[model samples]
Target chain A: MQIVFLLEQVVNGLVLGGYYLLIALGLSLIFSVGGIVNLSHGAFYALGAYVFVQLSGTLGFTAAVAVSPIVVALLGILFERFILRRFYNEDPILSLLVTFGLALVAEQAIRMIWGAAPLPATLPSEIRGSVIVGNMLFSKYRLLMLLVIAVALGGIWLLLNRTSFGRVVRAGIQDPDMVAALGIRLQPYLTTVVMLGVGLAALGGAMFAPITTVHPAMGSEILTIAFVVVIIGGLGSFWGVVLAAVLVGVTRGVTIYFAPAASEASMYVLMFLVLLLRPRGLLGESIAKFES
Target chain B: MKTYQTSRLAGQKSVLTRRTALKLAGGTFAASTLGAPALVRAQTGPIRIGHLTPMTGFLGTLGGWAVEGAQLAAKEINAAGGAAGRQIELMSEDSINPENGATKAQRMLERDGVDFLLGEISSATSLAISEVAARNEKLFVAVGPRSDVLRGERCSRYMFCTDIPNTAMVNAVGTSLKQDGMVDGKKFFTLTADYVFGHDLLAAAKSFFDANNAELIGDELIATDVTDFSPFILKVRQANPDVVCLNLAGNQVTNFVKQYAEFGLPYPMVGFNLNTADAWAAGVGNLSGTWPTVWLDSVETPESQAFVERFKAEYGKIPENHAWISYIAVQIVAKAIEETGSAATPELIDYLESGAKFDIMKARQAYFRPEDHQLIQEAYAFTVKDEGTYDDVYSMLQLDGAVPAPDAPLESIYPSVEGGACKF
Candidate 1:
């Protein structure tokens, strides 16, 4: 019976990890290709939730969820062109500070527009409630969300592996200078990567608005965990983030089962242990540019 | 935002830059006003008050409303005629957390030269500010924190609490639960906020459970920053308690409520502590539980309804309980200053402890208990209305009339002397 309960927690943690993957994968992708941390990635996620909430009031849930990510992805073009483009080849600290500042500005801007209150967003009626499988209980909406996330992960994997665009983006992540020397213009690839990265984050936000508090500072809260997952996964490795997200999620759940107070702290402990043993991360390949 | 002026003449030379002069002025104020009698310091000029609350965090939304309430009170007081014939000048800053809260409170006293301190939503931060006020021997009216510890063993001579304490909140909801036959022989699972506030609430809830013969089968102490509750929810399911009790605060309540609805658990839910902002954020259909609140906009009183109208007109949204508490705190302070003819700490404290009652836009006038300095006032319990009954989030809660009944004593629901633990 105790084992069954622990197993149930593991399964629930995996579902949570899938949600974390939605935000962290985008963060890792942006870092891998552009060498920018994109601190404002969470801002796009927050905007996605806000937009979904606003639109869902008028257009209903399905249409709002469909349109919110596209809207945020379009904003990614302007973000890459105006702000992110300048610090690409500069000191990493410059981009970090600028994006950090932008994150604060984005939060304040959200407060000014939407007020400093959490907006109420509800799951569609059909998707409300839970499904019981033998001894395990699962939220129906979360199951649907897990399916959506799997499809998204699949789509993203194919886009990165089997396309001409994928080849350029991969090359750009390895050596931008060599890619430019080959007349490949890595600039366009960077913008597309940022758009896709932030769009995925926004989709995470839209999907989660119903379950979490959609307020201004939510971006910063999710951003911290996203950074944790990215660090554990190592920079520039897609599969590394996927693995780290699941590990962090499962660790948190199992920790809660035994020692509930340390549930949130378990991820940091995992990160510390991982960094102690494998500094470059589980699947992180050595990138020459960042080593310097 | 009060600017202190220092006029220094060194042989007819005034060469300090504007910024440097201001800095020098702050230094001089700190030096000269360190131990001056409050009567001497507060006799002239504006009644400077420092307002510290979290402007960005889990409690930020309630703090936003708190600022508006205090601002409206200050504006109305100044417009009508300022407190004690002096303009009530406010210097507001964000009390981010406990360490920062103490630092800001120290700065407000030493550099800003505030006569009194007010406003806080987090009990941890409020406890920090109370310690600073005690060290300085300045009056601090804690307007929003509901932690019983603030009025208990941690209580200070120089601090007063305005919000309903945790014991009272448990009693408020416990009364309703008892009437509905939900108390006896019930097994309870609680998800508590893991901080001073949440711990204090859990203690009060344990007492309520013990007194009512209810059993606590399982409990989880959740961190204040946790936004996820699925793992904890699964634990609740495994425990399979008869009632799901929440001892959460701020955004934690809304997050848990929304997710609990998503999970669609079988157990009925109830909470000992809930702010109106958290309830509104959970929206209409997501939140379905009996919760205790200090005050709500739907309270049937002309003054309460008028204040709600004014708040809606100003902010384009209905006022939450934090706003009401802050607004009435300023009014209470103003009334004290006006009646005492002094803003001196000792005089104001004496007048407040004299058992003077003030209208807090409620049926019964509220007064501070001399033992704990907690305001004795009516609290109410609310249950979410059925789906389709409320058109908007603000209208979703069906607020019960004041607890302890109109004929019952207001302090009947409050923590007893042994439980409150105040020495002074």
Candidate 2:
């Protein structure tokens, strides 16, 4: 019975890890391609939730979840062109500072527009309850969220692996100078990568909004976990991030089952242990641009 | 003008320019030194109140409401010929965390020249601010923190707590649960915030359970930064307790309420502590079960209703308890300063400790308990209205009548001092 209970926690953690993957994957992608840390990725995630809340009131839940990310991705275009474009191939520190500043500005902008009070959001009536299977209780909404995330994860994997765009993006992450020498202008690619990266983050925000408090600083709240997931997964490694997110989610869940006070700290401990073993992260790739 | 003058000064390097600059500086310095004391003797400067609250973390939303409440009260106080005919200069800042709360409190006293300190929502941060207030010997009117330690063993002579303590809250909700026959012989599981406030609430809860024949089957200490309660919820389900109680605070409560509803756990949910802002933020149909609150927007007193009206008009939203508490805190401080005829720390402390009653927008006039410096006042319990019964999220909580009853003493719900840990 105890084993079965722990197993339930592990499965729940996997579902949670999928949510974290949504934010962390974008962070990893933008860093892999653009070499920018993209601290404002969390800002886009926050925008996603706010936009979903605002739109859900009018567009209904399904439409809001579908559209919020696209709206934020459009904003990401402005972000890449006006802000992130200049910082490419520049000092990583400079991009980090700018994005960090942008994150603060975005949070304040959210506060100004929505007010500091967390806006109330809930699951639509159809998915409000839990689903029980063989003595295991699972949130129906979270299970649905897991399905959406799976489709997104599979879609993104195919986009980066099975297409011509994926080939260019992979090449850009490996050697930007060589890609430029081949007359393939990486500017549009960089913008598109940023759009996709932030769009995924927004989707995470939108999907989690019903279950979490939708507040201005929520971006910063989730950013730490995304960074942890990214760090443990290794930079520029898609499968690495996927593995790390699941590891983090499971570790947190199992820890809560035993020592609940250490649940948040469990991820940091995992990162420490992983870093101790593998400095570059579990699946992190050695990129030419970042090394130089 | 100052920038232009400084740039011009930097541009000139000649001996004659240096001599002219030094002479001009000397003349201005002498004039300012001579003129400053005359400004002080007139006694017409604004009374500066240093207000610090958590403005960016889990408790940030309540702090936002706290700021608005204090701002409204200060505006009204200033508009009404000021406190003792002196305008209030409100200096509000984000405490951020406990270490920063103390640092800012010290800076407010030593650098900002604030007359006194007020405001805080996190008990940890409030305790830190109280230490700073004691070191500086400035009266600190804590507006929102409700941990018993703030009024007990760790209580400071310079600090006064406005909100009801953990014991009062437990009693408030516990009484309601007992009335509904949910207490005696029931197995209880609790998810408590892993902090000073939650721990304090848990202590009060344990005592309540012990005295009432209920058993605490299990308890989990939850970190404040935790947003997901799925694993904790699963543990609760595994335990299969008769009732699930929460000692969670701030955004933790709202997130738990939302997710608990999402999971649709069978156990009845109740909590010993909840803020109106968190309850409202949980959204309609998400929050249910009984909870204790220091103040609710639905309280129908003329003053309370009028304050709520003015608050909604100003901020275009219903005010939370933190706002109501802060609004009245400023009023209490202003009244103290007026009756004492000074803003000096000792005078104001003496005046407040004199058991003078002040209207806190409730039916009963609240006064400070001289022993612990806690406000002796009414608190109430609330149960969420059933789904479809309420029109909006803010209206979901239907408040019960004031605890201790209207005819009973205000302090009846509060803990009685057996052996005092507080010393002046």
Candidate 3:
């Protein structure tokens, strides 16, 4: 019984970590490639969840989940173009302030649009209950979420590694000046990266909407986890964020059985230890001076 | 000379006509606008109650219910010529956070000149308003935040608690559940929110468990902001407890309950501080077990029925327990004011603490105990009756039992005026 329970924690942690990785990837991508902190990443996530709630009513559940992320991506493109670009060439502090303001604006907008109440979003009838997995009970919707996240992570990996666009993006992360010196249009690619990053956050939001209640502050709640995942995984390292999310999730999950109060604390304690040992994170490369 | 004289006479006549028309219009407009506001003032001037409750955040829906209940009371009171023949006016602010609640409450009390204050959900926010009440020497009726410490060790002379304290709620539910044979030899696991109210609830619940010889398998205090309950749910499964006692509050409770149902956990659950709004947000199928609420729509009392009907008529839904508490709080204060014929802070507080008994939508009349100013009222244990169909959302809950206040106020489901802990 103890072993099964421990195994269940591992299973639960992996799924939760996958969900976190989906959002953290976008955050890390924006930071590593786009070179913008994009503080409103969580707001886009909240927007995705809220969008899923409304669209699910009209478009049914699956279609809403599919479309909500795209809607957030479009919003992200507009945000990058109109609001974020101005601060890109300035001090990183300015971008942080702008994104922080954007996050607040997004929160208020959600409150005004949907009210402060947590709207109930149910999974489709087919995925409403749990499924038996080798004598263990796992939520079917969660299982679906995990599968979808796996596909998403794979797609992101291929996008960054297998494609020509991936090389340009990778180059931009290492040296934007060199990429631009090669006559590559950095603006369009950077904008795309921002949109994609935000879209990933939205995708996480939309997928997790059925399980997690869609409240206005949800973005802020998940924001910390996304940031932690990225930090632990090593900023700018794609796999680092993914691996960190799993570690954090598993640690927190196991901690729930032994010391639930310490679950969140353990995650932070791990982050603190990692920061002390390797400030650049587990898989982070050479720490470059952040240029204004 | 004759032509110039005729032109001047014509100009003077035109000027006189324009002045006369302007005077007529100005006089009429001033009288109409001035009289309207003056009439409004006469109808609404005497007593102003500041409602500083959370109309946003996790407890927003709960606060909205409170507003509906209190505002309904104000409307009814005004319609029947208000407290002490002075119209009752409600000035409400969204007490979003503790700091904001304190600032806005101070503004409302000192600047807005509210005769009294009412409503709050979060424990910290409620305490902030009560602190203001204590400092300013104003009467504040808290309709939410069921912490016993608020009215116990930190009891305020002017603060009236309308909601059941954690001690009362835990004792009420614990005793009722034990009577129903859910406690003996049961190893209960608790998932509590790591906050003031959750801590109080856990302590109160432990008392009940200890009294009944029910073993506690394990307990965990989760952060209030955590939306996920899967980890804890898995823990409960691993522990294999007979009962899963929920010490969560606000939207956390909603998320936990819904997820618990979704997970199909076999452990029967009981909780302290479960709100009707939480159940509503979780929807029908997710809610289960017998929990104590200050009031419910399905309460059998005539006053409760009347309140539910009136609130439904006004708000287009059954009155939630928060609404009931708000309504009862206003009623208690209004009665105090009417009896004393003053909205003065000390006078009203004195009247309330004199053990003034009043019907609180309960089986019998409840009174504010002078020792703590905690309203000693009957609390109901509610269970969701699985009535084949989910059409009647309002009529879904059945009253499992009523926990009456003991003859000795100190021994009531509430904490000892000195040592506060009630077992659930």
TM-score, every prediction: 0.95, 0.95, 0.84
Model 1, span B99-148: residue lDDT tens: 99999999998767798899899999998999999899999999999988
What lDDT does model 2 reach? 0.92
Candidate 3 versus the native: TM-score?
0.84
Model 2, TM vs. native: 0.95
What is candidate 3's CAPRI-style docking category based on DockQ?
A: incorrect
Residue B268 local lDDT, model 1: 95
What is each candidate's DockQ, to 2 decimals? Answer: 0.50, 0.56, 0.20
* TM-score of model 1 (first chain only): 0.98
Clashes of 1: 0
**Which prediction has more favorable TM-score, 1 or 3?**
1
* Top-scoring candidate (lDDT): 2
Q: What lDDT is reached at residue B416 by model 1?
A: 78
DockQ of 1: 0.50
Residue B293, model 3: Cα distance from true site in angstroms: 1.2
Candidate with the larger lDDT of 1 and 2: 2
